[model samples]
Target: MLVNKNRSSAGFALPTVIVASVVAMMLLLVAASASTAIREGLYAQHYRRLAREAAESGVVLASKCLELNNDLAQWSNSAKLRPNTDCKGAVVAGRTQYIQQDGNVRTTFEVGEPERREGSIQRITAVGRTELIRTTDGAVWKSYEYRLAGQAGLSTLLDSVSFGYATGGGFAMSGAFFTVIDEFGRPRSAGFNGFGQLGVGSTTDTLTLKQFNIPANKRAVRTYTNFLSHGRNMFALTENGEVWGAGLNNHGQIGNPGQSVAWVTNPVQFALPSTDNVATFVAPLGIVTFVVTSQGNVYAAGLNEKGVAGINSTAATIKTPTRVPFPEKIRADAHSWALDSQTAYAIGESGAVYGWGNNEFGQLAQGDINERRAPVRLGDFGKPGKTKAVQLAFDGDTVYIRDSAGAVYSAGKTNYGQAGVPTFRLRAGVSNRCLAAVGASLRTENCSSTAANQKWHLDRTNNALQVESNPGASQNRCVEATGHNGEETRMRWCAWWSGGKRFDFRYPTNSWSYVYLSNSTDIGGRGLCIIEANSATGDTKMDSCEYYTHKVYAPYNPTLEQVASSGVVDITTDQYFATMVYANGEVKTFGLNNGALGNGVYVDTSNFDTYKRQAYNPTPVKFILPPGVKAVSSWTTSNGVDSKNGNTFVVTSDGRVFGAGSNVTGQLGIGHIGGGTNGIYPTPQQMLVLGAQGNLASYVRSGYGTTVVYANNRKVFTVGNNSNGQLGDDTTTTNPTPRANKNTNPQRHVKFY
Candidate 1:
């Protein structure tokens, strides 16, 4: 390159000037390209960040909407444009800001609909926009937009609520006793055959809301008393402390105090002082009598099968209230009553639950399945410790009791896992003496393991346990041991006790401890649970559940009358009642019986007065979670693989979320069953996917079971039962095999595990 320096006195030649200008232009072009690349990178970063923020903002917005409306109605329809409505056009508690650091750039967020399902916040969508900060006219104005959406599912997958009907047609205080609707859109009272629970004190069933007297003041003036079921009959305690018995009293669940077989029609007086003349005795008085006929004391009456009358060794049936024993030294805390065939239990105030009569399934909790004649102490606490009991509930043979500390304990016949523990008892190390201990000891431990076939043997009889040709096996297939018989033909699978011996088998339909049944005709509503007490929003805490079911049909007739035809109209719609539980120690009943828990309540009934039209409904007390739990869910199974490496979550009964719902294999330790179109549940329960430890799961879709869940732990687990390669395992051997496929990779299998 040669410089054309001019020979002229003052300046260089025009050519030289032109060359210098060209070089300068080239440098400018290079610098501009570099600057453009940096700017583009910055823009991309901002866009991603804004998108995430927008999605989070949408969730906050949706929560605010639900707070005000209790249902998804707020997010269901579009709202008119307003300045402060955020992206969803709803006012939220949090503030959102759009920032622009670069020159001449703009960003905005747009909101979309909210999808609520299965007691969960399924999805929320939002958009963020930004405009160019600099204009063509040399002005600065940034322009950009981003859209984000969020889907918040339930914390757990286990069905916490369960419900069932008592029998005897119609809503009755004594008969049937369906959990009916109340004015507040919750299940406050049970429908009785008579006005006992109806409050009219009549035998006629009130089919219309008008038939029942609606007090001018609709506040729940009466707290939930006690509800007892025995021998096909149901007994209820009122806020005024009065006792009402209905149904059959063949066992004397509703008899008078100190007497045997003395039955009352409706709410009857329990033990008042007895006098020969009896001129001072009062009837239909608002007196609280714990004893049926004994005045001012705890008494027993009716049939005394085995000296259960508490009459100090009396074996005869008393027709009147008989003085038993009501310890006055300690305040009679809370109490609960349940019956299994001819036996019953009365959990008392001092935190002591007692039992008598039948001993089937060991419901008496006396470490033995023997019927008692009198009330025998079951245990100090529902479990082993001194933790005070918060509440006690009974469902058939299962008794559920939660302590003030929020630990749930259950015992009795866990045929359906209502007892909340593994029902199988391993009989590995057994001898004649060991069998004796097994019969006496209430606790047991698992101390045996076998890589291949193991056999059952008596340690005393032989030095070596004999392995049947194929111990724990059938013909040619291998199986895992299920805590069933130790000695078998080929040890390939285990058998868990299904109530007792001779009932151990592997069948999917009956695999689950608690099976889902039909919706309750007595207690009708969606599922719900009680999360807190003294809630400012209302007297209780609740959540709602959605179920996939056939279209519901309205009741066509009530007592042979087409009530809808008359002006005294009754509306019939088929929707499950949302669950809600009151602070007054009352559990509202609702929805399907198998999955309803928490403070789950009922919403609708065949009786007109049984239905509440409010947008928000109440239910009975669902499953009580561990306290301090903001959220409750079942994200894992009993397998060790689901230890919540930030995959699963468990909420304390107090409504706090402890961990995330991460999948370890297909199982999550957070305690939910599973998630899929066919696997997803309305209530929170524990998940039992089989695979190695660590979060690993993949689902096909909501219900279809396309997307499979392969665990990240070198094992594959499938939700919705992938019988083929969808589960990613080499073998298609385990159809509905609730075990991990160790041969497959775990990362590829993705699910909401």
Candidate 2:
């Protein structure tokens, strides 16, 4: 039994010991897991903070690079972002966009993730295009620099043209729909095929006819070719919605650039913030251009047959494109027309097309003939594409336009192609069919046969050619000279009214001229007026007398006004004069001498007058004095003497003082004297009081007639003119030099009653 019990106890001990060992092992594992978790959490938090800091550093680096290379042309098209570019180890890595691949350029964006474990580590990787074009074109520069923050917008009509004239040269265009001038004197136009002006590839001058390679959409324009420009350059547009121009000035129009000659010649892409250039407006057709020019600015240039040239007359010329006044950044939706270099017809962004400029042909649309150099509203054409443009073309001699959606019209010189109808002459000698056809062909050839001297007339009675007039033809059929007393020949355009019965060429009877026309008719209209060449009538006399007068008076105005009583001679003049009165009782003047209460100086004098003129007028009384007078002051006496010598005092300019005249009782401040000779001193005497503290041993009151003297400490002295105790020493004694006052309870010093 004892042996079995001991065995049982040993088995129990073994099991118990094993169980305790297992529990202790389990507790150790749990503690290790918890500690590991806490350490890992801390490591992760630190890594995240560093990662964020690295990212912020990258952003700052990018911004700095942008600023550093802001003025560089390459920056305009360069799309490289280098975060690792930071040398301070702030940014672990950086990502860039738009890198070069092979021979091509493209755009790409990248990102960098920070790996912070062994200090600060980061990985930079980019997944985007790797090519880009680098050139600083006007459009690109404008977009890049003008971009506020990160975006930029363009507004208003665009034009293209060029010009040459006297005075400072310049080009014109529109920005934000406002007419503006560029650096070049030439008007802005797409005549120069370079610099992507017409959005075309080649840069050449095609005067006769040529096609433009502008893409159907506007956004693609800039993408096709990029250019770089630096300094004094310019660009402009026409009134025909066509942008043209040339200028790269660093001053005035184009702002301050660093270099010179940044001329641009082509219709660059421009669009406002909310609109897409590719979506709204119609793309320019082949070889067609729209042009706009103006003295008041606001010009467009491009193709538009619907009277978009803004040329209201036929005699005017659009030398170049320019800006027009419109709401800033607002797209102009209305139509316009130019009558001449001076006048224009504009349909406001909301109003009708008004005519202005040289209104010699009644082009002002006011039913009268008068030269105007501004815009005037024509009949309303608010309905969509429909416009009240009577005729919108230039006939070397006149302007032609049909009513809105009506027949063709004409205005100005009707000698050649002025009248778009046939003309007739005497066919008596030739009855052959061939001759008749030739004659008819010539008349209908848009020419007046200047060599033949024959009238271009249509058959009003038979709707066919007439050999001769029937004795009494309406004089209205005849082209007559009008305006300026027959100085201007009126162009008559034939109209087939009354079912082709009466054929009368209609021409503007008044004067105005045309500067630009749309891209529809030749001479009259056909393509946009890229650059409207000036007419032979270009007169530097474009200025009027009233204009000169207005300018002259613009800066003239009065700067001062004088307030004067009934008869006061209060002179009003610039305050640049100085006046001097002399002891000789004369006034001397220097400078402008506006006006003062002094004697007048002689106006005229000999050349030998060297600072020498009449000293003064009313001679002053002289008070002789010894060479060394200390102080001076005037005094009065109780004798009631109103003598001039009694009221005088002098302090020499050399620090000496002297006194003279009246001495009622030492009032002259000299020693006391007898009443008669004492009070009538003509000679000035010196007062010596150097020993008195705060030594005011003596003083005189010339204006009010009184004298006083005060000692250093608290002593007081008085004399002179004591009619009412004028001398404040408690006593009414009118003494002179240094009198002592011991009357008042030693309280008050002195008083001038």
Candidate 3:
């Protein structure tokens, strides 16, 4: 019995030990599973953070690309993306991927169509996806996707058309549309689409503007239009300084070689002298075209009848653009061309105006009827002691020239009084009306030529003119009218007169001989003049003058102020503030100030920097060329004082550039800020670009706080504020120092293609 009991105990102990070992193994398995789960959770959190960062970086990169290549047409093309090894190119349409630190992290980005809304707002969408390592299973990976939508900086170019003398019968209308460069540097158009001048790839017209179909990476800077009789031709300049043309190719006015006389519906790039950049272009009416280069040279193409092309040749039709030999370098700042039916005129940099082609009606202002094949110096106004012709305008058979003094002089046919010195006097060969002081009614009677009532004299006053009766008599009194009513004339003491004693005169028509006399103190506030009630010898009375039709020639002396206030001055006189007279008898400035006086600032002489110590000038001072600046190439200024932050930029001969006024955003291109100031360059400073040959700059343009310039080597450089990536440097990150909000200097722009 004892042996059997001992065997049972041994068996029981063996079974209990096996059960404990099984429980221990179960506990070990549970601990291992918990540790693996914790490790995976940590890995996922880290990768998620990295993926988010990668996505944000991709967004910035994509935005840079869009800013450079504003054309949405080819945005989906991989070649247009311009991706490098760092970005790994686009994986799909409008998408680009990047691998960071070898294979550790991968990020991809996709861009969506841009939506332009009213009021200059453009919305853009971007999506970014990142792939991250998650588990040892290698096949299983973690993916993080991010989306961003933001406002894009865009600029819109609006269509504009200007007619020359539309109301005066010199009407010339252009069915041409303009190409505008948006803020992103893309070309957009609106307006007359006849002959595909709008550049929308079709001849269909559009009242609403649309974008152009062109290379996705190209940016246009300037556009030109030539209104022909049947169709209008257009020209565009790219940011790379390349020239392109579209529309009517008839007569080779489009500048394209070997092109048929067919209309071009889209822009076609053309080549000129590859080394020279086009500075200015003009397409006057007819089949002629002119182009000015940065090198101070002028070129012409197309019809050459009467040698209107200025090529010094009588070729009936010139097929391509050829250089026109000028006597002197053409001023890039003020150089321009004006065309009439049979003649052409050009202005040189030295303030010399030249004329070519027909001079039948003295349209060339050369004093005689002589046509020339080459440019001839205009002798009428370009002489010493006279104002230079800064700008010119044509009115059919007449040519109107505006001098630096803002005075307008016309030459050509005068059959309808279209050209001549303005004259204001009584109508000749008509019975004169005589007025005398007789009660409240100013009665007018047929005059005896020698009577005192008919022989009146004018006297000048502080702000008006006084008509004196019987100046030869001892008691000469002031002659006054009652006003618009047919009231009798009365004599008053000149010193004690109340209101009607003073009179003002103005011209009511384009005719130089028409004049209207308005009473200053008249109760009815109407012009007073003699009106015939019946026959030529019948009773006459002072009555309301029909301003639009009534006119009289009175040899009344006047002052400069009177002429300006007469409201009869031409448009040029009304626009310019100061006139600049050149030594060569050429008036280079037409007293008009567009806020771009180019004399450093916009303020009058009284507000000049040295005004407190020097005499104040009532007119704008002449814009003295800098020491080395022989001539002005091009100039631009901020809109006006209303802009608040105004600035000026001037490109000069010899490829030098200068800036004045506000430099808050480094728009001056001087590369540094003023001491203790926000970089406001009140005076002119030479602009400099680092790493450029001779530090020379060729072309320049400016906005609120941004400045763009082209180097002599064909490279583009930018300076100033870049908060909106306007600098085109592939980054929105701004300079940390200086103003803390701007670059405070210039940087080279990245290549878009």
Candidate 4:
């Protein structure tokens, strides 16, 4: 029984052993499967992360390419897709593959067409995909879609011109010219090119626009010209803040120690102080030249008569630059400076006017004709009730001061209607008839025995005018000019209740006898004017003021509403606030602080009684920027103020460029630099680049004294100020140096690095 029991037990043991072995094998197989699954999952995650990283790298590369060249068309070209090279060609269109680490990592990216939206905003869609990797059951790829938006850079294709102006006898007759940019950023000139001010390398004047030689990588960012004399000197501030002077250096205005009485044909660089950057350069219509460093220190050179150089009386000729001694550290906000032949003016951030040099005509506004050797306080600005003086304009012996109220005042030489007071009346030269409001139409009729209808009153309280029937009595109706359907002029009722019943009176010429009456509602005087009807009645009506020969009589009043009509007048038409025109065609006329017009800022005037004002706009109208424009800056006049009549250069969001306004000095960058053809463009003009294959303008700046533009490849082109090689053309021909055989076309191009 024991043996049989043992056998049975052994058999049972064997079966149990076999069952245990099978269970062990099943557990091992399950563990192996689980381990393999975990491994596969980890691999998939790693490959996915790598693919995402690769897509991100592709996006970064594309962003860099766009930064270097913002042109979408160029970015879409396959030739430009090389990762090793600078985006010289256009951007890649379709997907382009990039492989790394022996095919372990790969990415493909594609850029979609750019969409230009309003407000100079541009959007681009880019898709990037990583190489496919094996998964548990199939293959998978990672991708990232990105929407990139930015303000477009400047464009490469556009009509553009660079213009400049030199000081002349008066504001009406400044020496101005222009130069046009070709498809590749080359420049040509037209207009006044005397004394090689145009930097074209020759003094021969051309009646038509012509091309000028320019150096590579040298372009003007700011321009300056002399103000008070015919010895108009030209200066250019390059994109790098290097200054060059040409023409009229008889007084060593070119900053060279021995360069006197010579006309510099090419631009010569100025030996500026060791400062890193120059904030601004002021070469007023005088023999002296001033420079303001970023540190706010002022430097001067040229003739030191009356201590105009701001150095000392001992130096008669400032052969080199010297610092100016101010009573206190100059305020950082003091960015503007104006000079006449005899006086210099500067305004501090505190709104204090500083005067030096000659004060013979009270140009300093110090209430006396005492000359100042150094900067001295001239006006009671920043006071409790006073408006700050924002800008200054000089005409012959007179000084025109523009305040925060948008009103201009004269401190010197009030003759020739500089005081804003009308010296003449609108008496008919033919029938001895006077301008009278007959019903709703203006007509030439017999003057009232008491000069009632003949007498007109300027209501300066609100910048309006009234035609009174009595000397001292108020009339409900004012004189107004109106036209219907763009037809001939007709007289209309300008009731006091009418919201836009204001008129702007201006003297187009030096003569005070004749004036121009434009409706305040009409900016730029487009088809709005007060003119004499051609009929036998000689009736005055509101017609197209486009006739440059039309003239009217000044309104007479018993009490002086304001100063006489003289110098420059900027009226607050349309809106009582300020307006700003940006490069992106965005215009904001309201929400401006005092002196915030023309890229300048004034001290806050919330506590002052003086009204806040902006730079005077003859026509208070909004300006539309060219398509794709993102930025704009106006040309600085000789007075260191941006003139509405001067040029405005614009840079497109995609790096294109255009210009508008006065092209007298080829500052507009258009190809009209010579030929006495002074173009006053009312709208933006496209700027072409010479030799620009596909290069686009990345930046633009205007100093009415000079003009400059820059391209994507870092190449620069300048058209003004070659006297001191400020344009970096490597030649110097000073003005008034006899026949130096220098280029006088203001539109001449100079290449700058």
Q: Across residues 122-211, which tens digit of lDDT does each residue of candidate 4 receive? A: 444444445554455434454323333333333212223334445434434344555444433334555555667555666555445454
Between 2 and 3, whose lDDT is larger? 3
- Model 2, residue 180: C-alpha shift (Å): 22
lDDT of 4 at 370: 54
Q: Per-residue lDDT for 1-753 in model 1, tens only?
A: 987765696667889999999999999999999899999989678766765554455555554554344334443346621224643466555544443335555444555566553333345565555555545684535444455555543221111110112222222433222222222211222223332433344544432221122232221212222222221333333323444443334444445553233233343433334441111111110111224322223555555655555554555655565555544211232334433234545555556556556554455655544456666665565455675544444443445445554444444433222233322122211210100011111111221222112212211111111222242234222221122221111122223222111111111121222111111111224322111122222121122212211111011000110101111110100012112222322222222222222222222212212222211121223344433233322221111111121122232223222221223223222333334212322233343442224444321111112112333332333332232222324433223323443222211210121
Per-residue lDDT of model 2, residues 449-567, tens digit only: 23222333434343322322222233333222223322222223224322222212211112111111111111212111111011122111111112121111100001101111112
Candidate no. 1 TM-score: 0.34
- TM-scores for every candidate against the unseen true structure: 0.34, 0.22, 0.41, 0.41
Q: Alpha-carbon error at 717 in model 4, in Å?
A: 17
The 10 consecutive residues of candidate 1 with the worst lDDT sum are: 553-562
Better of 1 and 2 by TM-score: 1
Residue 448 miss distance in model 2 (angstroms):
15
User: What is the model-wide C-alpha lDDT for candidate 1?
Assistant: 0.32
What order do you get sorting by lDDT, best first? 4, 3, 1, 2
Cα-based lDDT for every prediction: 0.32, 0.28, 0.47, 0.48
Which digits, one per residue and each the tens of the lDDT, describe model 3 over residues 1-753? 454455665556767798999999989899899889999888666666655555455445555554444422235424322223223333455434454533645665555554553223355455555676544654426676666565544344222111111011122433323344554555555545555545578777554446654466776665665321223656666666656666555666666666665566677655466666554544444356667777778777666877777788878866677888887767543225566456777777665677777765455655444577888876544566766656755533445555566555545433212233222112211333433333223334443323334333334442233333444332445545543352444555666665656654433333333334445444455556444443343444455655433234332111111112111112211111222233322212222122334454443322322221111122324344556454333333332222223445655556666665556656666766442123444446667652235545655544435556655542345666454343443344332121211121212122111
